[model samples]
Structure formats: C-alpha cells, structure tokens
Target: MKRIFDISMSLIALVVFCLPLLVVAVLVKLTSKGPALYWSDRIGKNNEIFRMPKFRTMRIDTPAVATHLLGDPDQFLTPIGHFLRKSSLDEIPQLWSILKGDMSIVGPRPALFNQDDLVKLRTEVGVHALTPGLTGWAQINGRDELPIPVKVDFDAYYLQNRSFLLDLKIILMTVYNVVRSKGVSH
Candidate 1:
C-alpha cells in the first residue's frame, strides 16, 4: 500500500511540476558551473548506498560534506543557491528517486554517505530498515536544526507509527514547513 501511494503521488507530482522543474533546472544551470542536478551518495534503506539527485544548490568547488559541516556554506552557494535552498525548490529532482524506488515520499530523510555517526545511531535504533524519503517527520519537526540523535529518534518514531494517515499528515506538515520556510537553517 505504501509503495503504491509513493509511486502514484510521485508520478502525479512529476507531471504537475514538470514545467516548474524545467525552469528550476535552467536556473540552476545558469547560476552554477556544474550540472543542474547533483547526484549525491546517500545512505538508503538498510544502510544501502544510492545515488540521489537534488538540484545543485552549491558550486562544483564546494566540499562534499554536509552543508552544516561547511565552515562557510554561504561562500559555496551559486548565485541562486540560497534562494533554491530557502524555497526547497532544490528538492524537486528527488521525485525521480521516489519513482526509481530509492526513496519514499515520507520516511527518514537520507543521510550523506559519510555521516557515519548518524548511520550508526540510526542502525542501532533499527531506524535504517525503512527507506529514505524526500520529506519526513524530522523534516517537518525541525529539519536542519535537529541534532543527529534527535533526528534518528524521530525516524524511529516514524518507523514505529508509520501508516497511510501518518504519511498524509507528514506530507501536509511538510507542505506547511516549506511554505513558511520554517526550521530550515540552511
């Protein structure tokens, strides 16, 4: 049932946002030196590694680390990068991940491949059994602001309480957070 919901919703999203996605792609290309889509090595379900695409919000020269870990993340931003991040437009390409079965519409957001501590903690708590997502409980709750352990705790909670209705609620809350630009530090 969850898989069906993810596929259906992701397909609809890809169709409805098609033109806007094109526009964003062009914007990213024009504002940055790298490809419009950035393929990141992200940790997925059961600790599997997968290539996840996001609209490139940072420059090609930017270090391959979490944005929060960068000493001066703003310095690496392409001209429109900050705007893309703030608006959450950079995440549009992740619909493809959902379509490809590497991600769900609602689950724990994937961790960067090098985030060992996060992976370990989530694994210890059995939160890594579920697939990663474009938006999740941690995202709507605090997003970039939450600490790793707390994020894993939220993931565990979602794993335990997952349901169609919970996913719907998370999706709606994600919409609200994205619209308000709340809780996103980067």
Candidate 2:
C-alpha cells in the first residue's frame, strides 16, 4: 500500500512539477558549476546503498561532508540555495527517488554513506530495517535539530507502528510544517 501511495504520488507530482523542476535545473546550472541535482550515497533498507537525489543547495566546492560538521556554513550556499533549503524546495527532486523505490514518503531519513556513527546506531536500533523516507516521524518532529539518538528513537517508533493512517497523519503534518517552514534546522 505504501509503495502504491509513493508511486502514484511521485508520478503525479513529477508531472505536475516538471516545469518548475526544469526552471530550477536551469537556475542551478546558471548559478553553479555542478549538476543541478546532487546525488549523495545513502543507506537503504537491509543496508543497501543508493544515490539519493536532491536539488543542489550548496556550493560544489563545499566539503563533501555534512553541514552539521561545518563552520560558517552560509558561505557554502549558492545564490538561491538558502531559499531552496529553507523552503524545502530542494527536496522536490526526491520524488524521483520515491518513484525508483529508493525512498518512501514516510519513514526514517536515509543516512549518508559516510555517517557511520548514525548508520551503526540505526542498525543497532533496527531503524535500517525500513526504507528511508522523504519525511517521517523524525522530520515532522524536529528534523536536523534533533540529536542522532532522538532521531533514531523516532525512526524505531515509525518502524514499529507505521500504518496508512500514521503515514497520512505525517503527510498532513508535513504540509503544515512546510507551509510554516518549521522543524528544519540549518
């Protein structure tokens, strides 16, 4: 059921936002030297690796590292990068990842391939047993503001209690969060 939901939503969204994606792609090309979409390796269910796509929101030359580890990070954004990230517009391209079954609309956030600490913790907690999602219990809760342990706890909660109704609730909260531009952390 979730796969069907992800596929239908992703397909419709891709068609509906095709033009906007094109425009963002062009803008990214004009403003940056790297590809419009950033493909970062992330861990998936059963410990699989997949390339997750997000709109490029940082400088190509920025360290190939997580933003949480950086200092003075605003220097890494392109002209529109901040807007995209702040508004969560930069995650639009992940609809493709959903269509590809590399992600779901509701689950734990995928861990970066290099984020060994988080990945190992997720493994110990059985968080990696589920496919990663674009938005989930952790995202609607506090996003990057939450500590890794807290996020892992939420992931485990979603894994144990996921359902259509729960996913629907998360989606609605996601809409509210996006509109208010809340829950995201720099």
TM-score per candidate, chains pooled: 0.98, 0.96
Per-residue lDDT of model 1, residues 99-154, tens digit only: 99999999999999999999999999999999999999999989999999899899
lDDT of each: 0.93, 0.89
* TM-score computed on alpha carbons, candidate 1: 0.98
lDDT of 2 by residue, 87-112 (tens): 89899999988988999988898888
Off by over 4 Å in 1: none
lDDT of 2 at 159: 84
lDDT of prediction 1: 0.93
On a 0 to 100 scale, what is the lDDT of residue 113 in model 1?
Answer: 98
